[model samples]
Target chain A: MDSIFAIPLISAIVSIAGNLAVFRKASFLIAGVAHSALAGVALAIFLASISIELDYFLVATLFAIFFALLATTFSKFSDIDTGIGVSFALAMAIAVILISLTRGYTAKLWAFLFGELFLMTEKDFLYISIALVAILLIFGFFYDKLIFFLFDPEGAEASGINTRLIDAIVVAIVAIAVVAVIRAVGAILAYSIFVAPSAVAKKFSKSVAQSLIYSFLITLICLILGLIVSSAIPISASAISAFIASIIYLLVAIEKS
Target chain B: MAIEAKDLSYSYGKTIALENLSFKIDDGEIIAILGPNGAGKTTLLKCILGLLRANGEISVLGRDPRKDKKVLNMISYVPQRSSLSIDLPIKVLDVLKMTCKEIDSEILRHLELENKLDLLFRELSGGFQQRVLIARALMKRPKVLLLDEPFNGVDVLSQKRIVEVLERSGATTLVVVHNINPVLHAVHRVMLLNKKLVAFGKANEVFRRENMVKVYGAEIPLVVCEEGVVHPLYGDQHG
Candidate 1:
């Protein structure tokens, strides 16, 4: 594979793994975290304008994890539905967008929102690689436990699985993976890549392991296809990737029906 | 005792689910927890399993269930069939593999699920789903097995098969059921509850007319059939 394909390959790996781990378990929350990450990106930009240097990926990951945790806690403790957390995320996203405009960081904001896949720096590649490795390692170590937890939480808890801790770890891993790939597939379109392939794979998979493998393959195919089409035409790569993912999902769904 | 609870109480906000519930189960004893819809049968099981916080004390295998993680390894719980989603693309074997540390082929054979291992859980009938859940729990060879509504959608033949398997396994079993007539012969003890311990004794002692009326708050038609005792309010069965 060419060095040019390395970044998107890593992004696809992380997207599929994170989506399988988190999206299947907490679908709405992943979308909420993806949108809420915009607030973190805005904050990082605002800090940079004030002559402070920080890792925007780390900042965005922390913010997304915080929002995810907040939502999980509220849903677990209070009578409020988990979807209520999505409203908070949307509110934060809008607030940060307005703040970014006021600070004259509109161009930077658009890059984070729509993504500039071709502009991925060497550092972005390194960060995504580390995230991919970390995600794979965690999943490898806790594959059975995670599957048990996701399949039957009550049964897992009864069997001494520490489901609450597992849930938090899953959310954090997803948050980091989503933030790490934001440069390759923007905050706005990240959820599409994260969920679509996994959802499609699940339609035909008979086991968790098979579902994961199918998810990775589907995501890689969509990424490669999107990159090829966008290179030929004057279209956004991330947008095309998102479109391909949705098309694949629809095709699978139609076949199933 | 395999399981013990003292002054156990749990409430959801202002609505009390269980109040001052106390019980003890000897090792290898099969006990059925009989109660109405909202009598906190599930709540009691959750408390014992440490899934829900409750006031007072609960000990499983001589350790506080809330403090010791090892207790869980020795306990197998089958939640209500409705609490699980069969639509997920999970095979019956996949569920067993994820849950049991060591699968017992004999238990699977007893439940007649050995042949259905490759089937998707969603494709099984309700009775077969319950059998799969039971098979998973039995595969663990747990010291204590807790089942909530194990026979809700189960048919008569499957129910008999399940009771026979449980009776032979000799695990300290606590089963929560709305009706007790099916497993009356298999159970060593019967616990009647209505937000509190109403009756705790043998099936004949707890299944009396007064205790039934007190627990159910209405007249429940009961009869002595060939199967032992039958609660006609739930269903009819032949032994």
Candidate 2:
């Protein structure tokens, strides 16, 4: 198995963790978006690099995003906006510099920049499948509680839900998902898997649970089709997935129209 | 008892928001808590909801408020209008759906908000926002409705309308009202407060010029003529 696939699988899990943790706090929306952007930037850097251990680099970036997100979101790191800007800027700048140093900023960078490659190993495929199952299990267990916390904790608490515990469970799920998908989409585009499906689903959802289910189905379709098209057409799975997602969004819009 | 408190004292970094306060609300009575600015009216409401940690014995719906939150859910809280941000990206009808159990189609129609359900919640006026919260509180079918300053910037017509709804609901209502005249007839009793309970009972008994002076200080010049009707001659700003 090519080591690069391992990175995305782990990344997918960790990214999900980060996204889920912030769903309870006041800045959940901001936290989700910022972490997503950071993940995208990191994956872009990896795509630009050569001779780098794909697993090590992906794990480092995941840790960096998780640590930075938690420190900035949970703690008062000189205010939220300032902390997000500074942390994200530093991480992206460092990753970009490293990528440039390796490749001298040539057109070859586009392969990584725009997701123009699809290389996978047997182990990576297995890991991703297992990670996907784990993600489903975690989500199913905490679905009701997480939905309640996101919408209204006062009501959640009134209904005898341990909001904080439920919030923690969601964080764990997002983290695992982020770790798992890191290779499939990379750091930069990983959140596309986490957020896009949910976002597009929002326009059509009647309830939080429905939106979540819609997002899961949309994600499953993207992963399968993206992997297939990339292997057959010599394109990057990341880019293919994004294109397919956009198509899905368009379909939704057209259907609504 | 529907609600009971004894020696209730709450502190916000030693500021003493509520000081050794004692009060009770019966099973089914509309009580108004009247006080000057900063007189701890809101503090009293929070104390009952257990939102504010207090040093006193408090019970609601036959359970300790600090222990069982389910018992607290039996009570609906209408928080200060100033504390909430309405401009968030949520529809008025959507928020109402989140509040109540069933989201009855007749609720907004009953509150005269049937046409404005699709609008952004933050886009509404202050009166409209309060009404939305009132509708949320009403949806709970709470045994006790604790409203804090619900009528700020409210028009007389809307106030009368709200009073009519509360009067007809038959729930135990505890309201913090600024105006005494309009509520003189609505509430079954009024609690005059000044960091403490100055007096508690029927509005006619507690709305005396002497009690008003005690609660508001000498600054409020109330003209209590020989006929027993009291009129506000000047505004008092004491707490």
Q: What's model 2's TM-score? A: 0.61
Please list the residue runs of candidate 2 whose C-alpha ends up more than 4 Å from where it truly belongs after superposition.
A1-161, A166-257, B13-15, B34-43, B80-100, B103-109, B113-129, B152-157, B177-184, B192-195, B198-239
DockQ for each of the predicted structures, in order? Answer: 0.64, 0.14
User: Tens digit of lDDT per residue, candidate 1, span A1-257?
Assistant: 23265545554565555555543456656566766676787777877778677787887877888877777777766532454365545647664665655466668878777776667788887878877787778877887777777777788888888888888878777777777777777777776787878887776778666667777777777677767887899888878888888888788888888
Quality of candidate 2 docking, DockQ = 0.14
State the lDDT at A116 in candidate 1: 66
- Candidate 1 accuracy as lDDT: 0.78
Q: In model 2, what is chain B's TM-score?
A: 0.89
List, residue by residue over A1-257, the lDDT tens digit for candidate 2: 34344434433443344334433332333334334434444454455465444453345435544645553554354654565566555555665665555545444334333433255557556766686677768776776566545655554554446765675555445544554444446555554555656556666555444555566667667766777786788777777776786678777778878
Full-model lDDT for every candidate: 0.78, 0.63
Instruction: In model 1, state the lDDT of residue A159.
Output: 84
A113 Cα displacement, candidate 1 (Å) = 1.5
Highest TM-score: give the candidate number. Answer: 1
Candidate 2 CAPRI-style tier: incorrect
Highest lDDT against the true fold, candidate = 1
Q: Recovered native contacts in candidate 2, as a fraction?
A: 0.06
